[model samples]
Target: MTREIENAAGIPVVQIATIVPIMLTVGANRIVPGVAIPHPTGSPELGKAGDKATRRELLLRAFKAMETEITYQTVFE
Candidate 1:
């Protein structure tokens, strides 16, 4: 709903969700695949270093997604 509103208001929004498939089904145009439902940014079990890397990767993908143009729902892995 937030995404829809933002888009409607001419605000380009990037959605980060653990469930990429579901977001795609709901017609989200820009999405970043989250690490998990509980820890969408990083996983505690991955240790500090690994968790930081995962978070960095997601952030990079999100920035890339924002720069890229798309006609349909797109997910950055």
Candidate 2:
């Protein structure tokens, strides 16, 4: 879906995925490695404040990835 959206709509997208290799195999151009499979943005081990911070960091990374220009698939590790 992400690939289709980017190619068909001519829009940039950053995919936040736990399994980075799979997303890369599927040709996801921009990827931010997620925290975990079940909790991609927020960690269950952390409290509310920590979770918020984690999510915020992920969002910031995504924004950074979106602003970057790449000729091929790129991972914002």
TM-score of each: 0.83, 0.95
Alpha carbon RMSD to native, model 1? 1.6
User: Whole-model Cα lDDT per candidate?
Assistant: 0.82, 0.92
lDDT of 2 by residue, 1-77 (tens): 88999999898889998998899899889999999999999976899999999999999999999999889888887
- Root-mean-square deviation of candidate 2: 0.7
Give the alpha carbon lDDT tens digit for every residue of 12-75 in model 1: 5788889888887877788998878999999789899999998888888888988988877777
- Evaluated against the true structure, the overall lDDT of model 1 is 0.82
Candidate number with greatest TM-score: 2
Clashes of each: 0, 0
Per-candidate RMSD, Å: 1.6, 0.7
Kindly report which residue pairs in candidate 1 clash with one another: none
- The 10-residue segment of model 2 with minimum total lDDT is 40-49
Cα distance off (Å), candidate 1, residue 21: 2.4
